[model samples]
Target chain A: MRKTQPYAFIMPSLLLTLALGVYPILWALRYMFYDYPGYGSATYVGLDNFARLMRDAEYWNSVKNTFIYAGGKLVLTLPLSLILAVILNKAFRGRQLLRAIYFLPTIISASVMSIVFFIIFNAYNGMANQFLMKYHLISSPINWLGADYAMLTTILIAVWGGVGNYMLLFLAGLQGIPNDLYEAASLDGANAAQKLFKITIPMLGPVLQMIVMYAITVALKGYESIMVFTGGGPYGKTDVMYLYVFKQFFPISADTASMQRFGYGSAVGFASAIIVGVVTALYFYFSRKMDKIY
Target chain B: MTSAKILTLVPRTILWLFLLLTAFLMLFPVALTVLGSFKTNLEVTVGATILPKVWQFGNYSTAWKAANFSRFTWNSTFVSAATTVGTLLVTTMAAYAVDRANFFGKRFYVVLQASMLFISIGAVVLRPQFDMMIGLGLQKSLWGVIIILISAHASIFFMLIGFFRGIPRDLDEAALIDGCNFYSVFWRIVLPLLRPALAVCGLFVFRGAWNEYILPLVFTMTRPELQTLTVGLAGLRYSIGSASETQLMLAGACLSILPMLVVYIFANKSFMQVSAGAVKG
Candidate 1:
């Protein structure tokens, strides 16, 4: 129980974070200012790489793509998860079993899920199209992986993979609400809808904020599924910022001449970090303000 | 009374239908994969059959050899197990210290935990961390990947520290009154009491490490011998080539998911409860 002994307890994790977390961030910052690649000596570029990113069309496309993906996911998935959570929160028979079934996808690897979705969303010979056609919903299969729907396809898969985790989160929040609040609202002649709006939504503000923050962050970090399904392909229609960064560093082709853009890629990476950081900070500011208001 | 009864039945029926539909949507992809795992490449692509014409259990064996899945699974198991143990030990000690031991930097530690709640740039950190790993001569090794998993998981442990802190200090004091030292108090009293939190944190770390793809993909490039299941599965995707639909690869993918599915089914309640509690906290 010595005063200093406890420091020994915390030192291992703190040191690990310093080595693996803090050090790499610093290294990335340093690398951004230098022209470094997987090979060759790094040269100090002094923001030239960043300056070049201002004019790079692909970087801008990726920025636009990242925002589109993040926005689409937030708009679609957040409301869906909230609705699902609200529905599942009601007392019903077999609810626990249903909860487990819904949560199964979130526990599995995204790579595995992506592959499964690839099959389901395949242009032909996939079950999804077969079902649609069988039901006479459409004459032909939807081109899910084509340029027009590729990004949408990615977003749908992301939403499907993600909704379960957030639903559980909202379920917890719903459970935390005291029953007396609902009783009071009922006594005031509030309908169920009115009670949900006045009592539940207001009380669940913090959890909702947390969900939005987590969802936005996840949307911004959408790489794994895109990597597996499209490889940002069918002519880069599915390309997002993270995929662009990956391709820059680890180009899949044999042409080393086109692959030596480490400085520019690092610049792009830094730009992405800045955008994500800004978005996260803005979310916090708004949430904190909302917290004060609520 | 009769009108009320009718109203209740309508809502209950609708709720049941909604829940059933949602559950079906969630479970359909997994069911398809499991069903497809039993079919041949020809049967998989040429037809739209819910049940395979002939169940080919041999696909499992084929995928096992094709992807060197045994070695990949071994590598994944070693990394995940080591990371889990490392995370538990480090997080437990840190949580114990942060929660029980009032120290000079308690406020700073609290801020550190809160900051961890926002640290979601693990993918961005991978490249630079790889550079640092290379500089430190730990690149292209399973140990390096394990270290990365442990570090990336520090936030979860930090959050667990907060959870542990919420537990009453009276328990620790009672243990001390019985002549238990700090270690004994932590080992016997606090750790046992924190099982719910521990299980939550442990499973979260395990699943994160197990399902991780990009980190291993980037870091373990030189050592193909050290690839994890995620990376191994990605490689398998290409090996099956244009000739194969998802059904051909479904068997391999299902095999990959079996370990997780088994773990999830047994521990589903604990997993859900703990994770839900953690998020709410």
Candidate 2:
């Protein structure tokens, strides 16, 4: 009874993980080599999918755009969140309220928030343009969602939505740093910048590494807001890897002529996963090497 | 002394000013959405004002009807509640067994879950996942989504295991010595002690299920009636024809945010602590 009891308890979750989590991945791997449209039997066209993937311009374009989007978001978000964390970590009035307010965006649905941003950044009369024109910040409203600025606009929204969560993480990292280090630095006549650069950031190394790793994976994976905002439009300027994978699987609009190419999509999906994996592995490798230097 | 005073005060004042400016930026969009929800569609489109000329509380009702929000709300609540309950049940049971008994393949199971947590396949496998649901004859039901959400419980399992280890085995042993079976020991004894851990995990699971977009979006594509609030709200983007229905969309956005806001208000402390705990784990 005791021996069988353990299996009884663990079986439900294990089986669930296997069926939903593991099975789909294996299914995708198998489908990668086939040429199955959703309705037909999959035909094994060995190495054809890989060869097509190599020649696919759109897939590689999305890969380039993914790096740009992720890179732009991280560049802006990390420093902004760090600064906010340092400020909020101080002893001040309404500190908790401030932290909560910043963290508020993180809780809201990304799609819903992006819709609101869509309104705010509307080309004609969006509050962003209105306010800017009202203040004479610009003579005319710029088309924020145009091809010239769509990626930039998306990055700004991403930063706005993401900064708070990372700030909270940074705040947690800040809290772990002992105060005596700052006090000792003060005894040596260290100024605010010196103390921050020399002591606080060094102490935050481990937490920072973890948060960066987390942020990288999330930024790469995130396409919810973009999907709602642009539908990978304006000549597919803002198309990321996952969004492209999604479009391949399910056409957003009825007019899509070449939708539901399951076999090729599975191949694309596999390639996307490998790219993400390789990037993650490279991050781990580089971060480890930096650890040795430090 | 006067020059020194000016130097110290200057930076401090600038710092406070900058912080307040950031706070304003953070609150602006949400404030605009809420206020816009009450304005007329023409007023919203004009962007000529900050406040509504006359508060149109009727927009909420209009939005509700137009978006089929009542059904979506129910669907969201049902899925989130069921996912949380199911996840808590299976994860807790698994955590207990793994923490207590030395079962065969136990190490392998733990390692598998850990690797699953690290190796995310993202949206790549959505096709196969949908196909698997069709295979199970559950492609038309919300149960497919609930099951998938519950299965992605690697983090929750690890969290519960950590919580489980902190709980002394002496209590379980005492219950067992009292002629209680393993199930009873779990049900009557340890389950009661796991309330704190359960609450945190429950909140997280509920929030994830509630705010989830992609899975529900894909699964409910064929059955529009099964769409959760997030999916339904996103569908409202252009569904009301060429006019865009900005006011209605704002009203719906506000409505979708309410349940999550209520949860956040009630458990504000736990929410902050969870973010902090994430890094440590």
Best by TM-score: 2
Worst 10 residues of 2 chain B by lDDT: B236-245
CA lDDT, every model vs. true structure: 0.78, 0.86
Q: Candidate 1 regions off by >4 Å?
A: A187-189, A253-260, A287-289, B1-11, B119-124, B177-179, B245-248
- Each predicted model: what fraction of the native A–B Cα contacts (within 8 Å) does it retain? 0.58, 0.68
Please identify model 2 stretches exceeding 4 Å from their true place.
A254-257, A289-294, B174-181, B242-244
lDDT of 1 at A149: 94
**Clash pairs of candidate 2?**
none
Tens digits of per-residue lDDT for model 1 on B1-281? 69999988998788678877878888888887898889877666656677888888887887777558788889889888999988888878987888778899867765765665565433446767776777888885777888877875546765686678678988888879999988888889888888877777788888888888887887766678898888877776666673563554787688779898999999998678765875655
Docking quality of model 2: it rates as medium
> After best superposition, candidate 2 residue A35: deviation in angstroms?
0.6
Quote model 1's TM-score for chain B: 0.89
**True-structure lDDT of candidate 2:** 0.86
Tens digit of per-residue lDDT, candidate 1, span A60-145: 78778888988988888877777778777777777788788878888899987887777778786766887778779999889889
Clashes of each: 0, 0
